[model samples]
Target: MNESYKIISSSILFWFSQKKWFVYSILISIFLLNLNTPLGLTVPAYHSLIILLLVFMLVTFEPIPFPAIALLTLVLQVVLGVAPPNVVASSFMNDAVLFVMGSLMFAIAIVHQGLDIRLAKLIIKIFGKSKRMFLAGLMTISAVLSSFLGEHTVIAIMLPIGLSVIKNIDTQQADGKNAVLLTLFSIAYGTIIGSIGTPSGGARNVIMINYLQEFSNVSIDYWKWMKHAYPILMIQLVVAYFVLQFTFPSSLNNIKMRGFKKNVVKIDVKKNINHLFSCLIIIGIVSSWFAFNDIYGLGIIALAGALTFMIFGMISWEEINKNTNWGVILLFAATISLGFQINETGASSWLVLKFNELLATFPSNSMDVSWSIMAVLSGLTANFFTSSATVSLIGPLAIELHPTDISFALSSAIASGFSFLTVISSPTAMIIYSTGLVSTKIFFKVGILMFCISIIILYLMSQFYWVML
Candidate 1:
């Protein structure tokens, strides 16, 4: 009887410990809900703020799965009388959410086609001779591929290749450790730097585009976005190469890569036809996005690409369903809805007003200063939370601050992709850290340097390049 009582008591204690953060989040939200704001916020606006804070904590701490948090967020809105059922349901779907879903599907199709093997052969062919040139080549390939294929996909493809290279290294030598670190970081930093190049590169870009359109009615097409962001991407890639080289300098001049054959394998006629068709389909979809995004929208074009692959028998639904991260999509949708609420309920405006008052004490209150401040803050916040979450939380205020200037909003969103401080900052970072070769100290040492460089470059682009455009 006593043992049975202990088991019951332990089970209860375990449950409470597991759910303590959830309880705290609920209690804090309730307390804030009851309070009156001096900023003249409406009850719904205050409720939105409470929800935002709760979600921010939950997402950061991850007390439960993110998808569950997203669903709970929607449920709590109705249960707490924050919004109606129809309104909450409507918020769950949007062009941005569809774009993310379709993009993931398309990415899965591309990966399933085994293009990474072809890419690896090409990379080995190009930069297999010299160590320095190989490092540069890896970074260049990673960045360029990530710009089009998305950072996560590029990282997923490149990580194994990097690890293979590290595994072949002689760790007994003194310079061996540095070589391994350099190789891994080359892929990581490249993927990160390139994610800012285009909308397809990262989810944050899509979320920002949607927010800009919904809130400010500013429409930026695919080519236009690439035109604005690609230059910054190019410069950052060069900077990243230098940064990695300087931080983790390798004394080895050349690496003898084993297990990589120089001879090309001849493909069968049927496989060749499929490869050609897949390439053509990808080109067609991307070209359409560039040429006709204003007419059909990016989301539709992306979905069309995935459908094309499925119809052609190049990919299967099972592959996409198993590989896709629906939780991220749900989290993104929830945050976007909350962002809209922040705008509609005047919470964003109030927060912007408070920020403006704080800025009034500064020596200069110019738009440039405002843009710089927002970019830095967003960049810093992104290193802790996901970039999508940072953008969703800060985007409303950015738009409210410069309601007419789309440049400010675009710059802030792009800058937030500079997640260089921690392994958890971005998936690319996490992937690199998984190799177990990169110590946190080395990651931070290199990351802090790159972060400083990125901020400076972003600030300069905002002032000079964006002004001309």
Candidate 2:
């Protein structure tokens, strides 16, 4: 009887330890809900604001799974009378959510076709002789692929190749650690910087696009987005190259490694047919996105591409289903829904008024100051939370501040892609961290430098290049 009592007590303790934060969140939310606002906002708006804070905390700490946090947000919205059940359900799914889902599916299809080996060989062939050139090649390749394919997909493909290169490095050499750091970060920072180049580059871009279209009636098509964002990508790539060189300078002038075997494309039978078909599908999807995205939308085109892959037997539903993180989709959908609630309930406007009063202390209300503040806030917040979540929180406020100038909103979204401070900042960072060779201290040290450089570059672009565009 005594032993049974101990087991029950331990189980209760374990549950309490695990769920303590959740309980605290609930209590705090209740307290916030009961308080009368000095800001003179509506009760529902205040509730939505409190819910947003709860979500940000839960998502950052991840005391619970992200999807659970999303679902809890939805439940609380209805439970607290912030929104009715029907309104909450309607906001949960939208074009942005669909785009995220389709993009993940398309990314999985591309990754499953064993294309990374071919890409790796091509990279080595182009820049294998010189160490600096090879690092440049990796960054360029990762950036370009990520611009079109998606950051997570490109990083997932490039990470193994990077690890292999690191493993093959002669650790007995003096510059071994530098070589490893350079190689891994080239892939990581490249994947990160590339994510802002186009809408397909990252889900956050799509979310921002969706927000602009929904809230501001501003539609930025694929090529137009590229026209605006690609220059930033190119300039940042150059900056990233220099930053990596400065941070992790390899003593060796050249690296001659022999493991990169050439993959010759043979036009022989079923294999050739599959490769050709896959290439055509990818090209077609990308072309359609660039040409007709405003007409048919990116989500449908991406889904069509994934469907074509499955229909052609290049990939399978079982494989795609297994690899896809449905939780992320749910989290994105929920956050988006919550963002709309914030906007609909006037919470975003309320927050913006408060922010404007703070900004009034500054000497200027010029566009430059506005742009810089939004960019810095979005960029810094993204280093701690997911970039998409940052966009969801800040995008509405940005739109509220600059209702006519879409550039401010676009800049904030693009700048949020600069996630260089921590492994948790972005999926690409997390993938690189999984290799177990990178030091957290080293990651932060170099990341802080890159982060500062990127912000300065982005601010300059906004002042100069973006102005011309």
Candidate 3:
């Protein structure tokens, strides 16, 4: 008895001294919070989702590494029985994960052999010869590429080129903000614009399509997606240019990146006809996304491109190993599984129940008044819960309560664009923010302004394109 007592006292002291007690206590609390769901305590599904979300948010901002977040996500999922080993393992194979990895592989190849920079220089030489011209040219090029390819991929490939251009330009000291703001806004707005290009341009766009096709009558295909999204994308590009002009007005007269372009072009890069062939591969893959809707999906095709890039010796297998962020891949999978949980555990319905009640009172004086009110509020909520997941939770409710209110559903859906509230808002935002160039607060400030302006634009757009005419 005495020896056991002494052992217990030593363990208690060690636990307290090492701060393990607090850690264990929190784990125990979470365990207990989730444990009662099976016993009829009626623990909210969103309660679990909220806990996971809080943990994800904290990990996102913490000094801890992203790999650590990946690890904790799985361990916590298992402990809470949110996902088991088999379920968590399956998350690793999510279509979004495959898409992300495949896209990154393509990005790696472009970044590696200097093709991306070569393309950028060729673009600048063709359209640019002056400062304002160069800026406009850059924005135009970024918008064009982002719309077709992917936004994060566009940023990864072009940011270095942009930075190098800035380095060469002898800007006046006072214009530093203009330079930084222009470059950053070019990336942010360009990316947002890019996402509107295709369903696959942004992950959320794909998710939105799935929601519509699955839950509603509109089964949008790739061409149909572009028909709706392209108009919005083009308008966004025009508005973004004006916004940038208002935000940063500079007159350097001459913008010479001649040396930069020459350096980019003349360099002896890893020459391969394979680079040219990769375009064919991409085209075939994309064509499959449209043409073979009866067959396998695009993720397989994209992943095949990545593999084919290696198998054909266009890129080395070692290169793929170096570029892939497996941690992020895992986190995406975990979040996807979490999305399922949030839906399955009655969390999504519960959330919609409450949010629908809130959406019920939009200070309606007229149809336009009610529409605009719902638009702004839905857009704002998108900033917090994310455009995809928020729409996932609230989409059905919006459709059901106001089935005829296309303006309401469409604004609420397209308002998915307002995910710039924080670094944690979207995969693209997270991808860029993980880079050290920007901060969470800076994104929030710029994003909030962008969102406010965009809310008005979306309201206007609903009148023209998506609203009940």
Candidate 4:
């Protein structure tokens, strides 16, 4: 009997230990729900904020699976009277969510066609003569591809290339190790900087676009987004190239080309036809996004791309389904729904009021001061939380901050791409860390430098450059 009691006690303790955050979140929610609603905020708005807090905890600690958290977010909206069932359901799925789904499917189709290998070989052909040129070429190509293909997709493709280059190098020596680190970081950072170049580059950009249209009635098409953002991407690529060089000083001037050559398969015409066709489909889709996105919407156009890929037998539905992270899609939809409710219930405006009050104490309402605060907060939050989540939560508040100045919205979205501070911050960072060769200490050190520089660049652009546009 005593043994049985100890076993049961131990099992209970283990469960508590594993689910402590979950328990804490629920307890806090209950406590907050019982408290009097704050001044200047409606009950529903206050409750929505409470749900938002719960989501941050659950997402950060991850004591529950993402699907469960997603379901809870939806359920809380209806149960806590945050929104009606129909309203919640409608907001749960929209163009922003559709864009995310379509992009993920498109990425799967693009990656499965082995185009990444072709692109990797192309990089070698162009930049193999010099180490600096090779790194710059790798980063530049990665940025351009990820600008349209999405950062995670580009990273998946480029990581192997980066790895193959450093595989034969003797890492026991300092220069060799630095060479490896530099190559891997170049690919990761390239994808990151590139993710802000176009609307489809990252889900966060789409979320911001969606909020802008929904709340502010402002429409920014694909090309317009690229116009506002591509210059920043170009400048960031140059800065990041130098940052990586300085952060990881390495001399691979005498490295051979055999490693890259060995990794790339010989191209045959018959086989290469499929590659060419795949490229055409991507081009068609991007063109559609540029031309008809205002009419058909980015989501439908993106989905059409995936549909075309399937029709041509480039990839199977089973493969796309298996590869997609449905939970993330669901969670994103929930956060977006919550964002709508926050705006609908005036929580976002309330936030803007408080934010402005905080800034009012500073004596200067210059664009730089206000813009810097939003950028820093957005960047720091993005580095800790996922970028999409940061935008879903923060986008509405940003738009409300300066209803006339779209630069606030644009800068907030752009700054969220500064995901250099942590491994879990972005998929590119996580992919590099998964190799187990990168030191967290070194990664953090470089990330801090990059984050600060990125903020400065963004501030300058917003003040001098973005105004021109």
Candidate 5:
């Protein structure tokens, strides 16, 4: 009896240890729900805020599967009278969610096309001349490709090339280790910096665009978004090169350029017409996004691209189904659904009013101050949480903060791309972390500097450059 009792107690303790955050989230949510609704806020709005708190804790801790968190979000909205069943269901799936699904499918298809081999050869010919040149090249190429192909996809392609370059290097010495770390960080940071350049760059961008259109009735087409964000991307590429150069100083002076080329496989696109054909399909999809996105929606255009890839037999359905992250899609849809309700129930507006009260305490209540705060908050939140979730949950509050000034919405969206602070902040960061070369301590150390620089650059661009356009 004593032995059995000890075993039962140990099992209970083990379960509690693993599930403590889950219990805390529910307990705190229940405690908040019991409080009286604040002044100037409806009961439904108050309840929605409680749900948001619950979501933040659950996502940050991830005590349960993301799909579970997502399902709970949907169920809670209906259960707490935050919105009706139909309303909740309507918000659960929208163009933004479709875009996320299609983008994931498209990424898997693009990876299957073997363009990375061709890209490797091209990168070697162009940028493999020297160590500094190679680092700059990786960042520039990654930024340019990621701006259109999405950071996750571009990283998937670029990481292999970066790894190949550093694979043969001896890491026992300081400089060799620096070379390996620099190459990887360049690819990761470049992918992140470029993810804000266009609407297709990241799901967070699309999420913000959806919020802007839905709440403010403002429409920003693909080219228009590029025009606004591309300049900042360009500046970041240059600044990031210098920042990374300073942070990870390496001299591959002894290493020959031939060594870099020998590491990557030689594959010419001309030898394979299918590779060229795949490129044409991608171009057609991008062209459609630029010309017809307003009519068809970005989500539909993205799906069309994935379908086109399928029709041509570039990638199999089985491949896409296996590679696509369904749980992430469900989580995005659920968060978006909650964001919609937050806006619909007046929670975002009420939060904005409270923000305004705080702003009033400041001496200068300029749009600049408000914009800066929003951008910083977005960046900080995004570092801890997923970028898409950050925008999905915060986009409404940003739009409600300054409905007339689109800069608030734009800056917040762009700032969320500063996913440099943590390993799990973005897929690109996680990709590099998986390599086992860059440690978590280095991530935090280098990330602090880059994050600061990015915020400063964003502020300058928003103040001067964004206004001219």
Candidate 6:
């Protein structure tokens, strides 16, 4: 018996050293802590935050897999007794999560039709034989396409094209491969820049919007989202371009471009005109969302436009299905449910109370102090949790701390989007890590630098663009 105990203790210690072990530990801890506590809706909310942090910590920074983290979360949630089977089960069916699924299907349609490739070729033709012009065109196209279709779809549709462009580098140069890497940076950064501009741009943005409306009362519709997001996106893109260009100048030396040898196929006339119709659909959806619905509920309009797309045969079910990432959807659902448990158990409230008490020692202006802490902590927390879960858990608390400075809270929320210390910080970090292009240390070095720059820029942007002068 003593030997068995020794072996089990060693195994538990070993598990913590591994990635998913700590995650499961936290999940179980939350459940056990809340099992007897009088937590309300907040119980699940706490679980959400804790679980998200663990999952991202593993996915981006550790070699542990995403699906495995998710499975561990599920099992721990069950064994710890934080929630009943039905409540845990229902998290999988959120409307916001479903919309994401539907959008994916729509995105796949565009890819399936060979429309994305044809469009890239058109872009290649437009840049007028200049490599710089061609790179700019790719960024522009990626941004526009990602805003409606979602970032993953945009990345999937365009990544190969970017690589192909790299392959096409003129053979006359000895280091043609280096030339492509520079252009690829443009593609990667531009895709990241565009991803924040719209709901469909990324999963977390949509999830954040839904949580904003559902939990808080801040309603930013499609048009309103564009109002603030477009400005940030444009600046971010230009900055990203200059940063990459300066940071990796060797990546762009002129070369004899190669490989786009296939004859350019013009999109059929019917689909050519379909672009105009798609434009109308986009415009109408934005206008209608603003004109109709309460501030907290504009998603129905996105759903409506999606329906229009389907009914009109602009994109088919198969296309949408192909684009959706059910794994991500499931992950979001599970985390949100956990967040609910956190809230209900009063764990979040208790944590906030303790934090606020600690903040009483700071002599600075409460608003400034609160926002500054939020900006930093949100980023740190996100290394362990997702941005959406970060927002869901901390956003409301930030607002509560400084209700008059709602913009400050918003700044913190946006700042939380920067998570870079660990690979699990954000979706982009996670997805890109999956591609195996760079090492963990490479990710850490670049990610930390970007995180620092983002903090400064995010603070300045919040002040200049959205907050007080």
Tell me, by lDDT, which candidate is best.
4
Q: Give the alpha carbon lDDT tens digit for every residue of 1-469 in model 5.
A: 9999999999999988988999999999999988899999999999999999999999999989999999999999999999999999999998899999989998888888868777877876898776688778878999988988898889999887787767777888888888888889989988999999999999999999999999999888898899999999998889888887888787865444454466545556553887888899889988888898889988998899899999987778899999999989999999999999999999999999988888888898457678889999999999999789999999999999988778889889999999999998999988899988988899999999889989999899888988898
- In terms of TM-score, the best-performing candidate is 4
Model 2 segments beyond 4 Å from truth? 170-174, 252-256, 262-269, 364-366
Q: Could you tell me the lDDT of residue 302 within candidate 3? A: 58
* Candidate with the larger lDDT of 1 and 4: 4
lDDT of each: 0.81, 0.84, 0.61, 0.89, 0.88, 0.61
Better of 2 and 6 by lDDT: 2
TM-score of each: 0.94, 0.95, 0.77, 0.97, 0.96, 0.75
Candidate 4, poorest ten consecutive residues by summed lDDT: 252-261
| Candidate 1 residue-wise lDDT, 335-439, digit = tens | 887788788888899888878888888887567678788888888888889787889778888888998887778877888889788887888988787777777
The TM-score that candidate 3 achieves is 0.77
Tens digit per residue, CA lDDT, model 4, 134-219:
88998999999999889888998888888877887888888888888889888888999999999999999999999999999998
Candidate 2 per-residue lDDT over residues 311-402, each given as its tens digit: 98889899999998899889988889889889999989898888788877888755667678888889889989979888977788888888
- In model 5, the Cα lDDT at residue 199 comes to 96
- Considering TM-score, which of the candidate structures 3 and 5 is the better prediction for this target? 5
**Model 3 agreement with the true structure over 128-241: per-residue lDDT tens digits:** 666666666667777667665666667776666666666554444546646655765676677766666676675555555544544455555667666666777777777777
What is the alpha-carbon lDDT of model 5 when measured against the actual structure?
0.88
* C-alpha lDDT of candidate 6 relative to the true structure: 0.61
User: How much is 441 displaced in model 6, in angstroms?
Assistant: 4.2
Q: Per-residue error at 345 for model 5, in Å? A: 0.6
The reply for model 1, stretches above 4 Å from the true place, is: 262-270
TM-score for predicted model 6 compared with the true structure: 0.75
Off by over 4 Å in 6: 1-95, 168-178, 251-323, 380-386, 392-396, 403-405, 419-444
